[model samples]
Target: MYGWIWRHLPGNAWLRALISLVLTLAVVYVLFQYVFPWAEPLLPFNDVTVNDQ
Candidate 1:
């Protein structure tokens, strides 16, 4: 399946790179703005506190 996708996508390297970058950014935006915030409180690191004495 992966090989078929690679073969059929495009012959232009730049175009493929650009499309991959756009898709990555879109996924990151959705994760940060929606998914991450919703799941933040459940993360173990969320309870860490800083103490300056």
Candidate 2:
């Protein structure tokens, strides 16, 4: 299955690498901005305290 799909795509090695890098960075950005906050409490010393003047 994987081999057949790769054979159909007409991009060179460098093009494929660039596309994968961009996609990975996009996913990481989304996770850090949204998903990471929800799981912060589960991590040790991850609490963010706010002070009001």
Candidate maximizing TM-score: 1
CA lDDT of each prediction against the hidden true structure: 0.80, 0.76
**Every model's TM-score:** 0.63, 0.55
Question: What does candidate 1 score on TM?
Answer: 0.63
lDDT by residue (1-53, candidate 1, tens digit) is: 74565566675877877776776799999999999999988889857799999
Q: Compute the lDDT for candidate 1.
A: 0.80
- lDDT accuracy of residue 14 in candidate 2: 76
How much is 36 displaced in model 2, in angstroms? 0.2
Q: Tell me the spans in candidate 1 whose CA falls farther than 4 Å from its real position.
A: 1-8, 48-53
lDDT by residue (tens digit), candidate 2, 1-53: 74665565558977776766776799899999989988887787856688998
Superposition error at 53 for model 2 (Å): 34
